[model samples]
Target: MATDSASACIRQTERFGAHNYQPLPVVIASGQGAWVLDVEGRRYLDCLAAYSALNFGHRHPALVAAAHAQLDRLTLTSRAFHNDRLGEFMERLATLAGTQMVLPMNTGAEAVESAIKVARTWGYRVKGVPTDRARIIVAANNFHGRTTTIVGFSSDPGARDGFGPFTPGFDTVLYGDAEALAAAITPETVAVLIEPIQGEAGVILPPEGYLAQVRRLTAEHGVLFIADEIQSGLGRTGATFECDNAGVRPDLYLLGKALGGGIVPVSAVVGESSVLGVLRPGEHGSTFGGNPLAAAVGIAVVDLLETGEYQSRARELGAVLGRRLEELVGAGVQSVRVRGMWAGVDIDPDLATGHRVCELLAERGVLAKETHGSTIRLAPPLVITAEEIDWAIDQLREVLAELS
Candidate 1:
């Protein structure tokens, strides 16, 4: 139950803030490592990790120190003037993504929009497509961003409804079907944008060899393959990129979420010079894209991934997570899909909804979130211990038993 302070805060927020999100009735006060303290002084393990933005956990020392140092030195100078931090951030991020260029942005949605503009411009300038005639192929059930253009091609009605007169120039195809994707391509197609592992769509993974086929088809058709790694990249999938795990490379990588070490909002479009080079100055930019504070934290994030420690943690820990979740398949959980440290567990509709199960989990001191009606996603911080993983699953098991 919520205390007076927590209830009062929730009431005030509901009264003033927009009703966009249906957050759990928990008011977080502060956090350290994998646990957060609520207003009532109750602690809970953070399982969602701010939708994977807090991969290193809250207030990670290196990231916090980087932010503190940058805050004391400088913050934003905008693109009108160069700050001392942007160059190193861009260089380090490019090296980390194994690409030649970086087009920084402030959010995942901004990065997606920026990549769209870049792909269209590239098609018109280099691919020889007619002006305003370039088309991009996207997967169904894909969740790239909430922006108008991004949602314009979305297959989910919840994301597309009430946002209409949607943008054209996008074709929809089945996510893991190579034949459908191939058939959707045309001479006017400029790029094929997709998520390597669909994080929002219940952590759905493609069929085996699907990514390799995408690479081959794009190279053969001269179409740019843009991977929206906002939720799936940056060591979330047990590798620097899910593409790396699959041994396939894309022409452009749309990255965000954990890139700022959860210290600031930092995102970017990483790609080769020939593709990202299409954007000239004044063509497309963000005011706070590469600000000094964001850059400092981004650089620190890159440094963390360079060690390969976090990726190894995800791989080893993910196996344990998968095994525990699979045990519940017939015990209230209808199915489960896991990759790296991320999982999508589908609750049996006869038992309860995912939201109700998460609420019960929260009551038991573990915090998680539901993606759809019956699917809940689990993405703990990479720093989480094996013991903590077991405890979180234990809480889930108890919740399922109670529901049963």
Candidate 2:
């Protein structure tokens, strides 16, 4: 396809597709490492990574090659027949997640929806909760995915607005507060669903030891714990699993995005066998759940994570980035909270707004989007090098200083 005017393309898309997203002006055509080149051949550093999908960066050669090879041989077998790569992927993902089983799905929302099923079923079968009274506890300001059941539990109004009558049976507690979670659960409560750091809530971190406390409390209550690591897992947060930072073992792990290496849509529910086994044959599935193409990419992604190279990179750069952000605190910067490669920077109310800073960033060759009105999230691909990190940071610092 020939590159057209980005605005024209945007108009065409808005005409056809849902107007759910209000995106920045750039329309990316190609990318490498942490940089994307738009249709007009202007380059911008990719700080969002498709909400953490591009942790390996766009069109990573190895992952692209995997997709190419798989495409040549086979793509989909519909889960009706065994594909050579699916078992390998399932095995690797399960092992990597320290879980006994893996159930593949197409999107993060599907995986989260599947998790809801697992949690509710486990409640009835294992926890002995009444059939209709299976309650799952979620933290406030959590963004699991956009499925009906998932959004039903979201604390964000915009995501859930006008989308109800919502799914019931979910309980909410203050995020990062273990005491609130403990108090919210009754005997019928089956599971506690949480994001390790509440990424969508301005990269909010729980108090130190909060995850550990959550671990202890869940264990004591025998309620399953679920970690929605869709945005933070697979080395995006300087750890294989963000829960590792606290050594918490969740009963269920929801994964997506980076699992497909930016090649295809893939998600999974990794958890103990008994809990996952609750789904009998024909209970739930997708046509492309374990397709060979996605399976191959999933395998490659797992291999990359096992090397520990990217995680180390994220860790090293994270410290430098955090220090740099801290220097901005109380300056034009209102506050900064960083975890691994992802950061949420709060803009000063008087100096400049997050949207303005992001627009200035776009002009300066760094691309980031604003969230929650005043915060801009930074989540470059893990494959970005030290030089690129410095460059992106310099770009942001320059714009922020100018705003100040």
> For every model shown, what is its TM-score relative to the native structure?
0.99, 0.97
| Model 2, C-alpha of 135: deviation from truth (Å) | 0.3
lDDT of 2: 0.88
Judge candidate 1 against the unseen true structure and give its global Cα lDDT, from 0 to 1. 0.94
TM-score of 2: 0.97
Best by lDDT: 1
Q: What digit string (tens of lDDT, one per residue) describes model 1 on residues 178-267?
A: 999899989999999999999889999899999999999999999999999998899888999999988999999999999989889999
Off by over 4 Å in 1: none
Query: In model 2, where is the ten-residue run with the lowest total lDDT?
Result: 1-10
Q: Per-residue lDDT of 136-224 in model 2, one digit per residue for the tens? A: 99998998888887888887988898899988999999987878888998999988888887777888988999988888888899898
